[model samples]
Target: MSSVSVNIASKVQLVLRVALILVIFGWILDIPGYFGKYYYTEQLLALVAGLAATITLTDPRWGRTPARATISLVLGLTVFIAFGYVSVRYPSLQLELASAPPGAVALGLLMVLGILEAARRQTGIFLPLLLLALVLFSMFIGPKLPDGFQTRELSFSRLSVYLALDTNALFSKILDIAAITVAPFIVFGFLLNAFGGSAVFSDLAAKLVGKYTGGPAKVSVVGSAAFGMVSGSAVANVVAVGSVSIPMMARAGYARHVAAAIEAVASTGGQLVPPIMGASAFLMAELLEMPYRDVALAAILPSLLFYAALMLAVDFEARRLKIGGTSDRLELPAQNSDAPDKHRWRYLIPVGILIYLLFFANRTAGSAGLWSAISIIAVHLIGPPAQIWHRLQDVWKGLLQSAAAISDIIILASAAGLIIGVLNLTGIAFQITLQMLAISGGDVGIMLLLTAGLSILLGLGMPTVGVYVLLATLAAPALIELGIQPIAAHMYVLYFGMVSMITPPIAIASFAAATVAAVSPWRTSFASLKVGAGVYLVPVAFVTQPELLLDGTLLETATALTRTLMGIGLLTLAAIGHMSRPIPLPVRIIAGLLAVANVLPVSALPQLGMAAVAACSLAILAWAAVPARTTPSLKHENT
Candidate 1:
């Protein structure tokens, strides 16, 4: 704890961060032959980096005592490096490590414990506990379970080795995608943040929507979406944009809880945004063996509908409350300050290039991310710097941030691998699918509802990537088994997985935003649920009609898109209990039912019946939504 030890600990942490970043870059771009040629080596390196970073960043002991912190780092680094070197040097050991030899089992158990500890350190106990429960199930419970859930008996040694040394266990597809694809995008996002991209996004959003009703809230929506496109974490997005937008909304006459809810819900949707959606997108592409671009493209319509619904709610609320214009306390610094207009253009260049390469050139997401990052850094370096020292400091800070971001992703992905490994080993996913089908009586609707419930339960207290990975492995297959389109099924879970961030009882993004807005977390959470209501129905819409996912003819897609958008608008109006006028309770109930009916595919209901019902619903909504006459609409009781 002395000054000298404190300096040494700081230096060690910094060095570890830089090393982690370098390793990620080498693995992503294949600059070093060793990283690209050896998959296990890269995976081991990621594990080591993640553990070191987690201890340095999250462990409280590290801050309290320099000696303990240094010792922890040194020990973690040494064990990981030794294991990695041995694994790399002796490929045959991977198979042998799974055998029942005492030494091998001991090493495997230690590695498994290490991975769980790392996961616990970064995330909460939920995910690590889930994985541990699965391990226990496979060893003790699974073998005894009858019929559908039965599995072969395995001893502790074999189970430990299978999870630790087997390719499918600790280093599975989730880890693969995280390392190869998501890491680069994560780095790019933090890099963008480090170089004033937040200011640029805020300024641009304000200029675009600052004059409209609820302009500040709209800015939060637009800015959060833009930032979410690059970053995957809802909590991180809330922190980055909510700090600015929440206060802006509060200053513009929005209540504290409402402001917090708006930012939380808006930021939560960012993971669903395209180009660089949450890490789930990359994992989906990898699992489906399709291009990442395809996953992103399919997400476009739903994402648009999501933002449109949020914007509409904001507009309607602003009108209802008579709130408008920029706040006197909320001036945009990037626009008003000496920061040149041309400087803002710097933000667009990398984004433009990223889109061009991702969609037009058909480059891999990782490659696109690398080029985009290079473009961003290049522009910053080439531009005039007020001081060389300041530029160096900025670059240094960006590097450390990028390292931390990548490490979080690596750890989450690595931990998720255990879930995948256990399920595959026990064939539990298949058993669960069959059980679900049986319970639902082969009804697709019931099956979807069950799957969604499971998705939410499993996704809670986990990051978007971890949630999607777990659900995709266990729940998504059930939906697919029910004849749902593969993309639709995966996207269904993806939506719910990200939705957990704002879902009540444990909304991480809402908690973070509430802290920033200084509002009650519970109130902000419920408010966010209301703000995000329409989006909650999107997954069901896509499940019922695949056209909503762009999996149909042009005409079919357009018709579905239009109807779905209208359904979303109507549902949102009902949720808010306001349109042009306050809808009566009966009318709101009717509108809500109508919205669901409108979103349902004709196959679910007779085509003629659906059309008639939709028409009636639309007419009723339009009539009820018309503004009431102000003074003499109804005769007074006195009269």
Candidate 2:
């Protein structure tokens, strides 16, 4: 390609990125509605799709080879034309769906193809292949399959039109949630980070815990949790916090794999934290038709249990390896030394406004996010005049970054919407649900195991939002049918889906951290499994004890909380093979069993389980208090 052409492509890409952001902001502010007109959801979706297609094709991250660039440019332009036609004709096409014109059907096919290609570029072949298989099955392959697995057939044009233009498919509620609800939050996160809120979070976490044993690891936990409130991405959280914390841990005598694992596990839990969780949480709120606050509130206990267990695990691992505190803490790269104390209010005020609006003022999540972003800008404007130009540049960069991030999410959501459309149109989701129930013999425990396995399996190599959408469609209904609370059921699948980021063979977050820590990815993954064990078990706890989700009576909630906490504490100790010193194998086994018994809802002998848990807790405490016969050399202990 000529330099002129390349420069033109880049400029076009920039324009598309800016336009995408403006369109979303326009929707949020009801700019069109204020002008005595409104965007049809389909039209808005078409525009987003068109802009995303162009921006992604021009994005150098995917590839920049001349041949690839030429192909992408041609394909992108074709998609732009197709989407443009659809956006203009969608209102009339809706009325003609049963007998759509040949031109519309051809354009619909182009639109679907373009979206699948964009999805492939962003997420890899797995999701796009899955979507293609579903489409092929719905159109041609289903009638040949065996009973129960087979789907109803549709013509190619009809299927193409439905997938591309129907509100349920490419332009779905899932996409709506992504575009309107999740995008603003993404903008808020980017802007906050740009304005140094992330540094504030990390510094605060360090000041609070960096003097303790395994302080860097603990700092990772607290810092990741605080940053996770806004990031809501496992890999993003790891990259942002782990870049600093992982090296800090290594310098403090932690193994590379251990440091990577700590960072990975801590970051993955961000998806489960309240206020602004992963994009899937907003989908959950919409799917359940519940307030977003309810979802956040229900998530509080499980998230706390997860982090608490993680905190203990790291502390015990540090003791076992005899790693000492870093009294002279590692200097954070992003920390501002000039006015660290003065800028604290800037971070706090926007976050305070966000929380107040979401929980107390009863505002929409989108509105809350917009107000929060506005507050951050307002705060930045009031800062030192010398920094104003630099901060304004940061805001612009954040807007572009947010547009790129949201484009990928929009593509994934569109693909997920196709999956949902196929299931609903062909009745496969119902059949699969029934088959799952039959395979489990109608037992809730068996059903949960099946669901968890499937959720993890489906989640491999997929982002959390995509994983949650797939499981929510395929696995959640079966769990819900087994007499579980709806929120608990959804939360169960979400946890397992999110955990796949740290599970072996495809632990994306852990592997990313390993790259930074220069350790074996496999070792980091297994270590993460050990460190984040509670995340695996806590979902089952919540499913069985609705009290964990704040859905039960006060007494029931307290009792469940106590048992679950003890269970998590015991489990952490067993996994680490230490209390104050190395636990004997037999004692570890006993503690593990007691942990299981306590965590599981033993409805028939609930009191017995509590008694056993209490006994185990007392025994562990007593053992820890007893002095070691010979103090081991702390400096020489092997990692």
Which candidate number maximizes lDDT? Answer: 2
Error of 2 at 422 (Å): 1.3
Candidate 2 worst ten-residue window by lDDT: 328-337
Cα RMSD to the true fold for all candidates: 3.2, 3.1
lDDT of model 2 at position 385: 83
The reply for model 2, stretches above 4 Å from the true place, is: 1-6, 139-141, 327-341, 624-627, 631-639
Question: For each candidate, what is the lDDT?
Answer: 0.76, 0.82
Q: Would you give me the overall lDDT of model 2?
A: 0.82
What TM-score, to 2 decimals, does candidate 1 have?
0.93
Candidate 1: the clashing residue pairs are none
Number of clashes in model 1?
A: 0
Kindly list the per-residue Cα lDDT of model 1 for residues 1-639, writing each as its tens digit.
Answer: 657666665676677677766666776666656555655553554354344444344333454677666565565565565455444644666556634678767766766666677777778799778887877887888889887669767777777777766768776767767766777787777777777665676667778887888888888788888777777778887887777778778877888898898888888888888888888888999889899889988999889888888888887788778788763222222211233556766777888898999999988888898888888777666555565556566667776877777777877777788778887887776777778888999788898788778766876677878888888877788788778899999999988888888887888889999998888999999998887778887888888878877889999888788778778877888888877788778877877887888788777778788778768777876775678787754467457
- lDDT for 529 in candidate 1 is 80
